[model samples]
Target: MQLHHSIGGTGFPILCLHGHPGSGGCMSVFSEHLSQRFRTIAPDLRGYGKSRVSGTFEMSDHLLDLESLLDRLGIDRTLVLGWSLGGILAMELALRSPWRVTGLILVATAARPRGSHPPISWQDNLFTGLAGVVNWVKPGCRWNIDTLGRRSLFRYLLGRQSPEAYRYIAREATPAYLRTSPTATRALRQALRAGYDRLGELETLTCPALVLAGERDRHITAASSRETAGRLPNAEFYCYPDTAHLLPWEISDRIRADIDRWLDAHPEVLRP
Candidate 1:
């Protein structure tokens, strides 16, 4: 598929996968930090960014693309960090090719589709309204993610509402949103809403994982995140209080530090 990717620094490899309506560039902040100690490989998932959109727009297609990318890079195995939609793909990759996955770091993701939930927070409700307006106007645009990244009205929707955090995310996330194709955005969203559950299968995944979510996240509720961590035999779940679904971007530093500690603590999951 000739996926466009960003690779920098040198050490152990860490393939970072981004979320919905976002390209590999969305994870640039996290990758920048990790690049100092690890070879950070971030790719624009098929259909997003500069990657070509060929064949079926399904999760299986992405999985194969990732495998091919690894082979092309001559990487036998490596740690993977997935955010949101990327998190789901990472779990699937671990299940499909356990030997190729050293460890997993899933952020702002859940094991299965969430059914009903409590009343939406005002911040999230406002976001939904704005998102609806953007989706209505552009149909497949990044749901106005560029504006969301820059505007303080939506800053509270993220984990950290500080000006520094907002600026940090705006720099990386805005480009990612701009790079995403409408076709890619629709395809991934459709796949996620298709009602497929892998809860039963998670019990068999033996590789260590770190499942992270935010307390104020409405996309994937905290309960779902906890259940996901509980289902996996070697998974650890952590929730940041008052944080929203944008944990990977909002709490990038903390997430990065936690990931470093996690990998160090689980040497068994490191590639030999």
Candidate 2:
């Protein structure tokens, strides 16, 4: 199945994958920054964004879509940037097609995300209401709002930046969040609850990797992200304080700097 994607710039290729319930548009900030030095391909994996939601899909299916995408693009090898669920897909891709992935930048993700299913609370409903109201007042968002954003899941996507940064992120991300497919969201939730973990098959490929996490991330534990770096043959890891799952946006400057430094360390990422 063809996937909807956003492509920009022209340099080293970097495949950007967003988390579940998120669209390629959510990664636009990172893509914009990286596009100067790298070719970024951000895709709305199988069931989100403008991509029509077909029936439920499994991890392998996502992997296949990515592989096919790369093949169609005529890219023999590329750098990878994955966030949350997207990070899992990156790891799987590196393992499945070793030569295809030259490097990985993983954020707020774990090798085997604990299969703990969080129950809905009043907070979720409260945020849902807040999101609904945002849509109510915003003329552009009147008819488009997915009121299923659960607590930090929404804020996590929005990021815990300064008030100005928060508004900036929210203005751009709210619509992306609202466009999330309900069926896709439910499928991902159930998959997590069903304890769908393939940990034994996990291993970060030999390529250099940069694993980052937030000390305050409640969704994907920092320990797990650090452990992922440990298991990697060549990897660097960092965990920021006072940040949550939205490290990509919360400390986006830091992440961008780190990406630059890491690329310098692994010069192979820049060469053909």
Candidate 3:
């Protein structure tokens, strides 16, 4: 599928990938922040946003879609920044085609399945169920933004994502979820939950990796992120106190600065 995307700024390219039930639009805030110093491209995966897909698909299909996108854009290789599920995709891409990735920035993600982290608490599960219902009932409904961002829920997801972040979910992620076929989302989620392990493979990733997480992240604990970083040959792990799973959106400024430092250390990848 020819996935739809948004590209801006000018410099070394950084492809930003969003999490499940969301599109490239979810990363709009982060992309805008980095666009001033780096070229940022965010693509809506197949079956989300303006992208099109047929039948069931897995991570392999998503990886191929990205490769095809880079090929069409005449980009041989570029920096990849992925959030949540997108982080998994980033690692997979770098693992499968190390030559095509210059560097990796993984935000609020784990190296394995959700079970690798501490078990989610009942409170977190409540919000998770609420989100699922909202997505199923009116994934594109802008009106449900307030309820989804209710203080209690937001507190669990993150100390609290910014209003802009909430709005992005209302305007972008929600619609993208609605646009995606249920069957497709189910297949992708199932695959992600199938205990996919890549700890042994992380050592093979030649590209430098920066793993960012929140100390308060209920979805993927800081321990999980640290474990993932430890497995990588060249990886650095950073955890923000009081932060949560919405690291990409909640801490864009910090992330951009960190990326700058990471890029400086790995100047080899800056060559577009």
Candidate 4:
């Protein structure tokens, strides 16, 4: 795996993991705030953005990569804040390496995958098979700012931002694989099918956790966040009312404030 990352800040290490279909740069909105109080590290997960994957991709591949990243950084223990797909990965990392994870902040994610089936539908499957023809016939139909803007998933995740701001960010943040690679697309579909059901495993998490969700999230329902928090012995759940799936971008300051209070109350978790 070839990983791309950005490291900043000065205190206890806090690793920020971006969601699917985006790169480490997605965290640009919150990096400055987090940097004021932490040694922040944000990385594009494999197969997304500039990260390169050499073999078959699995959810576990991401877990292992994150573990190696921390090891390479010489970070003994760190607080992890993950959004969407990244949130699910953060939970897995904490479960698999309790000692390495000091605490966890899961936003806009669930303990299980959003849908019962894979990431693709029958239409999508057919489209994938005829991708070459479709590309030839309609070169710009697959991915464009307009197409992305119309996606319910995008709306659900982004909530309500200025149209111009949303368009600007989308243009810069959207990944190339979202339009090109069948392999990356297939990996997401397959991984979601496998799901992130770890309710039973939550009992084993020694570190404190904060589960956050947007009240208006159309993708992962707020109920899922509640369910996730209830399963963890040391977890608290918070919902940002009227917000959408992109809680970090939609309401970064509020999220940061909550995190500050949560950390202050649980200082033991921050000690090296």
Candidate 5:
């Protein structure tokens, strides 16, 4: 499938991948921030955002879509920034095509998921679904119930997230979940729950990588990300205190600066 994508700035490319229950637009903040220094390409996955897929699709299809998207865009080599499920894809991409990945920025993700994250309740799901539909049908029109539902769901999933963080967290997330395929979301959640392990394969990636995790992330544990960094030959890991699954939004400025430092450190990848 030709995945719908959002692009910004111009320089070395950075493919920004969003997580499950999310769209390319979900990563817009991160992409836009990095765009000033590097070209950022954010693509909505097959079952998310504008690239919706009906019926059923496998996780392998997601991987294939990324490779094909790169091919379509004529991106031979680039940096990759992934969040949650997107981070898993980033690791897989670096492992499968080492020559194509110059560096990796992994956030709120793990090599082997603990599957301890909480699930949204049926009530919350109903609220989210409705809010999503409303947000999509009428742009910039949000109701009190919509904000309540979105924030409630986010809080539940990100139990460790700080109250102050919500200022930036729910800004784009509410819309990303809009028009998402429930079937695809459920399948992806099941896969994560089933355990996707790739620790042993990390040593093979030669690209410079920066792994980040929130100290309080309920979704993917910080220990897992740290372990992933340990397994990689050349990788740096950072854990932000008072943070949760939405690390990008919670610690936007800090993370962006760190990303800039990491990229600039490797002039070969940063130079236009």
Candidate 6:
């Protein structure tokens, strides 16, 4: 698979992996800011964006792809920032290949499948089901800005994305594999449902980690991020107030600053 990637800047590499239902292009929100200090490489994982899926889709498959990509690019070690589903993958990568990953930044994710959280409200479930139907029938449909209420909900769920960003997302963000391949879609859905259970494995990780969560994120509560941070021997935690799942877009500057400070504090791990 040829991972679609955006690469820029001149420093120790920071590989960014985006969340589910999104491609690496979604990281455009952070690209310009983080690129000033780090060589950020954001790749659309297998079955997302322009990346291809040769066989099964698993967290391990994504990890192997990342490792191969780094080796192919002559990068020995890198800092990793992964959001949502990507965060889980980042943790797995760090645990599986500790030497290759020097540091980690996990956002809107948990160390394991969130089992104890309350079930979704009926209204939320209805909306999600409707959205899934809409996605299936009219995948290219775009949301209108005139609908202020709906727009507000979108902003609440996804952060403050510009109108143009929404348009790009509606038109170009979805991968061909996701739209066309049933097997890939099924595998992805299954993976999202499977979640992670690596609290025990996290102890073996020598790399420092940062766990970030949005205060208003209902999907993954702030407590989950806190617990995830606690499980890691060398992990720090931060919460973004008034934000939801999309912290990178909602507070890119803050996220970048936190990462900058963290890197400065651990220069040995983020060597140029």
Which pairs clash in the backbone of model 1?
none
**Deviating ranges (above 4 Å) for candidate 1:** 54-56, 115-156
Ranking by lDDT: 5, 3, 1, 2, 4, 6
Clashes (backbone N, CA, C under 3 Å), per candidate, total 0, 0, 0, 1, 0, 0
Residue-level lDDT of model 4, residues 159-247, one tens digit each, is 65434334324443444335324555667678767664777788888689998988878777888888888888889899888777766
User: Which should have the higher TM-score, number 1 or number 2?
Assistant: 2
| TM-score of each predicted structure versus truth | 0.83, 0.85, 0.83, 0.80, 0.84, 0.79
Root-mean-square deviation (CA) per prediction: 5.6, 4.4, 4.4, 5.7, 3.8, 4.7
lDDT for position 68 in model 6: 82
lDDT of 6 by residue, 1-272 (tens): 55767798988898888777677777666666778887989887777777756666655677878888888889988888888878888888887878888888888998764533345556655554454345445542454433331323344455444444344444434342244344446665687577646777778886888888888776667777888899899989998887767666557678878877887898877873
CA lDDT for candidate 3: 0.78
Q: How do the residues 103-175 of candidate 3 rate in per-residue lDDT, one tens digit apiece? A: 8899888787453334557765676557546645555344444555452355556554465455555566556
With a 3 Å backbone cut-off (N, CA, C), the pairs that clash in candidate 3 are none
Q: Give lDDT for model 6.
A: 0.71
Candidate 3 regions with alpha-carbon error over 4 angstroms:
115-152, 161-164
lDDT of 4 at 38: 76
Is 2 or 6 the stronger prediction by TM-score? 2
Candidate 6's C-alpha runs over 4 A off are 115-184, 192-195
Pairs with backbone N, CA or C atoms under 3 Å apart (clashes), candidate 2? none
Model 1, position 165, has a per-residue lDDT of 47
Candidate 6's TM-score: 0.79
Tens digits of per-residue lDDT, candidate 1, 1-272, equal 77889998998888999887688888886789889888999999998877867555767889989999999999988889998888888999999998888888988888784633355467665765665455445543442655543242354456555544445445555556667777777777677678767999998888899998888787777778788899999998889987877776667778888888887899876665
Could you give candidate 2's per-residue lDDT for residues 1-272 as a string of tens digits? Answer: 78899899998899999986588987876899989978999999877778777566665778888888888998899999999999988998988888788888998897777422267578776776675456445523422233333342454433353443344345555556677777677767776778755456555477888999888776887887887888887889998887777777667788889888888889986665
Global fold similarity of model 1 (TM-score):
0.83
| Clashing pairs in model 4, backbone N/Cα/C closer than 3 A | 157-246
Answer with 3 or 4, whichever has the higher lDDT: 3
